[model samples]
Target: MVRKNIIISSLFLGLVSASPLHLKRQDLPIDSYDESVAAGADSTDTPPVGDAVPQNVETFDSNTVAAEVVATVVDTPPAVAQASNDTPPDVIAVNLLKRSDMNVARADGPATSCIVRTFNGPQVSDPDTPGAFTSYPAFSTAAIDSVKAANVPSGYAAVPNFVNLNAVAQDKSYITYTSSKLTSYDPKKCAAICDATAGCTSFNIYYERVPLEISKATQVPDAALGCPGNADAASATLIKCAFYGMPLVATSAKSVYQYQGKAFKVVYAGSTAFTKSSGPTVDGLQGPVTFGDAAINAPAPVIDHGYLRTQTFGTNVPFAPELCAASCKAQTEYNAKHGTNKGQACIFFNAFVIYKNGKDGVFTCNYYGTPYGVSYAKNRGQWDDSGNHWTISNSFGYYVPGNYVAK
Candidate 1:
């Protein structure tokens, strides 16, 4: 009975110890063989005991590592670059590089001290002065062709002061004057008189005409645009005569300026109320238009920007920008047909207009003459990098920089 109890205990323990694989491998833990396992193997497709066991896996490769590394790098943030420091930090000093030489009134009776302000036309000429403080030589048409040539330093002696701004229109047409005489040449009043009067188109506002006492030569008046300095006497009366027909617009401009150029409608200089006359007298040429009214309906003139800002193709503005830029054709045209009806082709465009009018359905561009524009256009091809690439221009002119568009 004790032996039987031992056997039962052993069987229970073996059952407890047997794993699933062991149970599947064989009905009994031990291959007590006597049951003929070989026969069972031949009869079935099942494995017995530990035969045909499973094995463990070991290694991998390199491409997978590289792919994982790339993924991680792509997920990370990139480094930021540095910023530019061109702009000033708050308050900073800057030089304007521009100076106004307006010397208001001098003892020489306003004739010798005041700066010459308003005038007609783009042509400027300074009479030859020999022993004078400044001598603007005999200016020919060639000088007028170059705007840089026209850019006389501000307050340049040729652009000197004037006193006794006394002007007179004699013979109902001639512009003549005496010292401190007329006492007034109100440009506004003159404009009014022009509007009221039919035959009137201009007024000879007076200022002292001081000639450069050119040695071995003749004294002459400084005339801006058209009138060149010739042999004339000190008794010569200088008059500023302006005419009509332009409220033209600008297409664009360049540099530190606002898009629209500065414009002052009134022709004569100074306040609206005062008109002083100063100078000597002379005759011959179309004299000033005559009328008594003190003011008129005159549109203001735009002050043009005198620089160039074109690209490899042409001017920066797409509209009528062509009107205001420089060109080789300007020189050619000026040299060619100067004596014709068009006279001189404006070398630079001081002003322009670009728009379609409902009345006309067409765009209009005008190149008002510019002393600086002409000069810059001629020289720009050498200095402005973009200017050299284009074909030689067959037109005349120069332009303003900043572009202005109004819808």
Candidate 2:
């Protein structure tokens, strides 16, 4: 059968949080994979940084619940190094290479980069779960026939192509999947399993790893223990984003026990809350705060890469970034149509302010809403009217708090 190998490189980006005990950083949305591609593990790598702060007395859960301003930890990766050709599962990040071209007649052919395949290796598949051997869905061959329509990156390396880097997994949490018999199943089912299980914020979908030729007798062992005698042996893993949860269809948890015997739990909703005054303790980071909102004016050119906000100029129409983005997006689309910057427009979110808490520990977002249209720095002096610099711009910047993981 024709198959595609799906891999991802661990492009480790760090996160600093406004709070940790509550596990902040929800606004961050790194690219996952293309809409349809599956993700894989790192074969080569580096690692960590600062400890996570305490999470009040509760937990952070992903359910539709609101948590408090808990402490957060930042991840700092070591410099990059060449990956070993036959690296171990966790040794390096996952990478997807283009295999042989496929038959054009087979509509949902290999061309659809979204169709994913995982690395052949040992895995702890939950035999009872429907997705024990899950695979990326064959969305549509349209993507395949559409590369002729893809917008190549400005300076992409000779590599084929990649879409959503945000979808890929940034954290590695332990897991235990239930099992079932149907080898083929819906991914949503697995998501449900995790969701219903109190603290399962996420889930993993496993398909047979490559080198499937190995005997079926040891297929389980092979996956669980990884290929025979490889020192780098470890199960290949990826994250599942599905909103709903599911039940595993192929394998069941070997033990009703916890992963590595560690207790399984999720961060409870609304556990912690932070105010303008107190932010989380980030390593090497000071309390200096910056509150940002989108400013809306007519569409303007994007000058740099940072948080963006906009304010309207004609009268007092208040602020809205989504509307600005829509306008900006439209302008970019226009550029594309007019052969101008073709699809290049700078749109900031609604105008918000960053509360620059200075070198001190004081911080707040608008810290005060209503009234005199939010505080403004006439100049960078004392809430004053002198040597100003932080000019509360006509447009506000997007609020991008650093990533925060609890210690």
Question: What Cα-based lDDT does every candidate model obtain?
Answer: 0.20, 0.22
TM-score per candidate, chains pooled = 0.16, 0.21
- The digit string of per-residue lDDT tens for model 1 on 1-407 reads 00110000000011122332212211111121112122122211111110001111111111232233223212222220000211101100100011112222322332323223222222123332222211122212212221232432221111111112121221111111112223243344344543343222223332223322211111112233212334332212223322111111111000110110111011111101111111101122111111111111111221122111111110111112221122212322432333211233333332221112101001112232233322222211111233322112112223222221111
State the lDDT of candidate 2 residue by residue for 296-391, as single tens digits.
221112111212212121110112223232333333344344432222333222233211222100101111011111132222212324432222
Error of 2 at 37 (Å): 26
Which one is best on TM-score?
Answer: 2
Worst 10 residues of 2 by lDDT: 44-53
